[model samples]
Target chain A: MPDAPLISVRELSKQFRTFKRREGVWGAIQNLVKRDYRTVQAVDRVTFEIQRGDMVGYIGPNGAGKSTTIKMLTGILVPTGGEIHSNGYVPWKQRRQYVKTIGVVFGQRTQLWWDIAVIESFKLLRKIYDVPQRDYDERMELFNAVLKLNDYLHTPVRKLSLGERMRCDLAAALLHNPPILFLDEPTIGLDVVAKDHIRQFLKEINQRYRTTVLLTTHDLDDIEELCKRIMIIDHGRLLYDGPLALLKQKLLRTKQVKFVVKDSEQAARIAVLEKDGRKIEAVDHLTYRIVFDRAEVSTAELLRQILAEVEVRDLLIEDEPIEEIVKRIYAGEALKEVSA
Target chain B: MGPGVRKHVELLVAYAVQFIKVRLAYRADFLISTGASMLATAFAFGFLVVLFQKVPQLAGWKFEEVLFLYGFSLIPFGLFNVVSLNLYNFGNDFIIEGKFDRVLLRPVASLYQVIFEVFRIESLHEVVVGLLGVWLAASRLKLAWGPLEFVLLFFFALCGAVIYVAIFLMLTCVSFWVEDRVGVHPPVWNLIAFGRYPLSIYSGFVQFLLSWIIPFGFATYYPSVRLLGRPEFRVYAWLVPVVAATFLTMAIALWNRGVREYSSTGS
Candidate 1:
């Protein structure tokens, strides 16, 4: 396994034989005796890898196997088919040993011991992870500086504010200084300030410890703040995998060029309409909204035509956002394919 | 400081210290609750004495002999509660909150976390009374014991403890598929209450079912048979380990299969 990636997954898939309901109690009882079952392909053949210290966002819509992938990586669930090697250990086959190298923090759930003070929970974690006394103290000190856990160190986790609790959870996950961290929706349901605090702490830890991080979240802000690269999965397959800037470069190609003409004239709108039927929408009196598909016309060319066609009062050209492009990508609209 | 024992000892000591710290945090609550629990159980035993003063026998067993069984049962039952009771709702929590995720991540066996560190601080009071009852029963019965008897008694107690935990773990393993289990497996705890009584009185198939199938009979019944100096089924003594092993293996397999179901289904 020398020179092997820190995380490697190939042709991984999971199929569930879900039970079906019949009708009445008699039917239920009969079905119980010899039931009919239907199979669901939750995760189709999907593959990806993460080198050590990479913070990669894993994303997909609901039922598109986001959590399923995370579970297989964390050793919580064994995949029905495929290979996953993390830190030189098969996650499910050798779960006990593999888990020692990883820390997982699920934002919706907590790992801290309930009913105990945060400090006590930390001590228990120190024991569970078997970190030496010196190392535990050093990590606690680092966490104090990074996550600001001292504010609620003596308070039970149950009583903490959401932000404080997230900080504590972050500290708990890293006490062992695991070489890898898996964060499932770590910023979900958090206020902006709280999300920022967690995102900041994550960046600091990743930079300081060089730990590989696999983060899955719905908040795109998490991606912008923490990840340099992302793997976008949809329909149980990778749609895009690259640096964040490249996805945006495609969005930059397609910019919205709006024109404010001299007066409320149908001739100006007619002229604008003639240029592009589907892409142009009448915003108001002599105002037109034109969407330029980058492949059909460059932003510069679209602007030059709009300026030439209308006597303008005011005009604005805005760069299209990547979120909208990804939306288009997921909607099955063809993107100008990136050259490999 | 040897590599293997280091982690085991570290985790045990950590939990022990954490439990102590938790107990200290609510000293008044701990004292009041622990005192009430001790008193409540002692009153039950006291009530038994009152009833025995009048009738003198239950199903042909004398009051002192019944006390011997009752005392023996509670001490080990309390020990099981104090050590392994974390397993009672562990599987449900594992399935529901995905705490089992952490279980898979640690270097040590998840079984250790489920089986140990389960100290029921609320029931620490019961241990005191349980020991006291065992002493009182020994005095009342005037039982003779050499070093061999003491060792045998310890083994019997250990066997009871393992069997009790094994039953709960099987129930926990079932929670992977079972959503609401508080009703389905009330028998696990309810049976602990019945263990206080002798199996000899249950009569017919009830005795057979509890004896072999669930092995409630062997836990207390066989050891007491040895205590009575009666000829016993020698093969049944080995059966304790066999039953415990089989149930543990089955429960673990079910747990593995259940986790597989959860990953794909995400339910």
Candidate 2:
């Protein structure tokens, strides 16, 4: 009905069995005779669908199976159970053919050869993907215009700065013009300026080409700036999946409202308005800060009550920061699980 | 040729061109490494000559026959070194360092991509010296060559190269499970070094080990002996292609299993 949503993953799961060894010499010798292994559920029945042209962020804490899920989607790792159908192809089963339809960039690793020039690496990828000469030239031109790659096109990849290498990598991945792109921490170690450049390029490609992008990153700024839909996974389980705005609204409801009153008498009267669940603190003799849950007390109603009580000179209302919201979400989930 | 095969060949050639360019950029290192390989081959040949001077024949084989076998062994070894040398780095660079994920992400078979990614042009010196050694021995021995013998020589060399590659692939695939253990190349190289001499000189077990266990003999000794018109070992010579195909299949199977077992390191 809705173009079948470009990527469909149904209850995909991955489990790993890792050997456990002891610390000392005796334990090492004992390990040879009788080995012990523990099974870890790295990704457990994670399910989500991504529509065409949607930029979705996949996020989690360390060892939360974010990379494992990305690897499965990119056909690098076979899922231990369940199914994944991206563009009508089962990723791991039809790996070689499926990979031709997608591009992947793991931030910590460069797909290009270390000693080769950026252009040489792109040419090699062209041959590898069998992209026609005309298409290759067109893509290179477009990438040069958008990514400003002409500056370091002839420089070897090893000599390029991190930001330059990442830009070239993004161009190389897209040279084949794949309809889907998977970026795992694509801006992991980049500075603020470089991160902005990569995010802008990704947003453009996703919009212009209708490319389905599934990005996994730790930097909240990356998620805030690029992703519209956010999926949070923890302990191999998907905890939240929906619009980023909705997630903020659901987990974060408190807003801070600061009022600058004309006199100390007005401030004292406003501080008395904190009788309900709202909290009021005296910043100085002239200013009063009120922290209230927007869901419980509407900002308009609070303003009305304040005006009815005393005359206010200036007032400012601010929503909770995304960083604080995300921290609370993680901490809340973690604490509840421990207590349970 | 099918379009798929043609594309793969083109990709391989493209990769080779880049690799050559990279090697050329470090001209001094390239020359030194190539010269070192040539000098090592000469030293091995010089040792054989000195040993032959002290004795008319060793292990029921003449000096010329042994020299031919030695040279014949290098052909496949050199080709393997040039084409599949990265197999030796599977444990360290690919597995332990988690670089194998890049190979899997490509739109080609991982084995095919890894095999053709880098061509060590410096190793070509081994092939040249090997061919020279074989020709010198053949001329000195006054061996007669018919068209069929020439065809057989080429066929055996190809089969020998396949066997060598198969063995290399199998050993390197061990990294998929072991993670990092310095790889199996060093011991495999030592075993291959034995093939430069007549298997007849070794004990019964050593000969069996070379002939069947690891099949180093099929790569060099049996092929060389058959080319020299020796009928006694001709029975084993017929098994060359059969053994090569079997080992190659096993190697691929092992590699796939290793890929499955690969618990990729790092986030």
Candidate 3:
């Protein structure tokens, strides 16, 4: 049979009514006697789907309901309205069974036993998940091989480095061989090398086990490397969804070039080219930035043009950043803000 | 559900192993903590005995009998510290640090995970010495023991454990909403200090309240009386824990409701 979607959510929403607070103990004391409540629409009517083995990035700014959406998808939070069918089970409704088929990693925390060796934590999980002895042994061997857990299998989690702790956390979450993994900020606060290690491992896992991954991360590299599709939500609403390439195509076609020109006269002419404004950005004197839109002029062609106009020593080019795209999306832009 | 003991024993042992291993890693701190706990409990119980040595009976029970109440109270209270102390603090760290989301990812019961994470050995020494005190007091009383009577006493002592766990479980469940008991809960150590002794000494209304409402009698007095061969409390043998477990179950249901609230709002 062809692959059915591993996760299908329809119109899931969550709202929280919070108490309005003033200040001081007296104000808190006042809350005890008489109450006030304000309602916050945390996750507003979000719906999406993920097929088996598809790695997708679920991203939004702070308070954009990113974590809330992940929570609902993981069956930790029940939606105020809507239907969710995942891995042939209704998550929150059949929690005991549903959780068995998924793993989750929260980057800011450690899930292993704090004082015990890493392997001990895995063994405990083995019993908790009830994986048979042989299966557990095999998985343990494989995890140790891939994660290099042998180096710290006997070290208490508290002693592990931040990167090592995250590795152990990932290993602990997956010991059950769950079909899907939910990773929230799994590379937050890590050094670049550490982040790359984790991202590469995640990619391998997704390919090898066909683990459908739903990731919420601050690092765009995580999205760029692992997720084939991107979903952006803001103010509790789903803003965009589709292929990463499609997302990149719509908004920005130019790689911006920045350089320090040696000649002031050359800078003036560059500004003239820039004011043409079709897709050129050149500032005179100290810093000159030239916008090179791919649809307008080839990057090499723009470089040749800039070379003829000015004696350029140092320069830099930048692809349109995801953060910038998200900013515009949050600014309530329509689909027509194409930089190219 | 799935061979309860068969499943839980190994896991609980794992928890113990981890707890002890952690304690061992901090050997100096463990030694100091153990000493401090033993000293504090000894002084407190000793002071109580001195204050009441001149009296005929405290709350209508003799000195040794009061020790029985005190002794039985420790088992469940100690067991609770070992099992659920981290669960009491989970609401704070889980929310502030956002670790609750990680817990939701696991394939086990949330309640089980919460309770299993902590292993508090700080107060365990107190309970051990307290049990010894009970044995000494029992010997001085020169009470004749029958096979059936001894079994009943043992079973009744187990009920004290049940009652303490039941109350603790209920209170910890309340933490999801209130979050801080250091401010909100009443000064039970002073007001319900009568619970540490026999409940028979309190007024009729107070006795009824402690026995049925707060159910502290199940933790101390009811079991003490049954061991004392008091006919009035003989029926409490079966009733204490069965009745208290019902209350415990209600607390657990309330905990479920609280977990749902947290998972939804994520505040």
lDDT of each: 0.75, 0.85, 0.75
Q: Once superposed on the true structure, which residue ranges of model 2 sit more than 4 Å away at CA?
A: A23-32, A256-317, A333-340, B263-267
Q: In candidate 3, what are the lDDT values of residues A1-340, reduced to their tens digit? A: 8777789988888888788765778987787777688888988877888999999998888899998787787888888888889999988888778888988887877877677888888888888888898988887787777777889888888899999999888988888889999998999989988788788788878888989899998777789988889888888988888887787878765578788877676666665455445445446455777665678768887777777777777888778787776677778877544322
Top candidate, metric lDDT: 2
Residues A1-340, candidate 1: write the lDDT tens digits: 6466889999989887877766776975676587678888777888888899899988777677888888888887778899998999888778777777889888887888777899988887877777889999998988898778888899988999877888898889899999999998988888988898898888888999998899998887899888998877777767777887787775445678777778766434545546454467778767777776668777777667666766778889876865776677678755446414
In the range A51-147, model 2's lDDT, one tens digit per residue, is 9889999988889999999999988888888899999899878888999999999999998899999999998889888899999999888888888
Highest DockQ, which number?
Answer: 3
Question: Evaluated with TM-score, which candidate comes out highest?
Answer: 2
Candidate 1 residue A214 Cα shift, in angstroms, is 1.9
The stretch of ten residues in a row with the least summed lDDT in candidate 1 chain A is A266-275
lDDT of 1 at B86: 60
TM-score of each model, in listed order: 0.84, 0.90, 0.89
Question: lDDT tens digits, residues B207-249, model 2?
Answer: 9998888999999999898888876698888899899999999
- Indicate the fraction of true inter-chain contacts that candidate 1 also forms: 0.72
TM-score of 3: 0.89
Tens-digit lDDT track of model 1 for B16-105: 777777777889987887788778787889888998989878887778777777777765677777876567666567766667766666
In order, the first chain's TM-score in every candidate is 0.81, 0.83, 0.86
Please compute DockQ, using alpha carbons, for every candidate against the native two-chain complex: 0.53, 0.48, 0.65
lDDT of 3 by residue, B21-75 (tens): 7887889998998888778777878876886777867756778777766776665
Candidate 1 interface CA RMSD, Å: 2.5
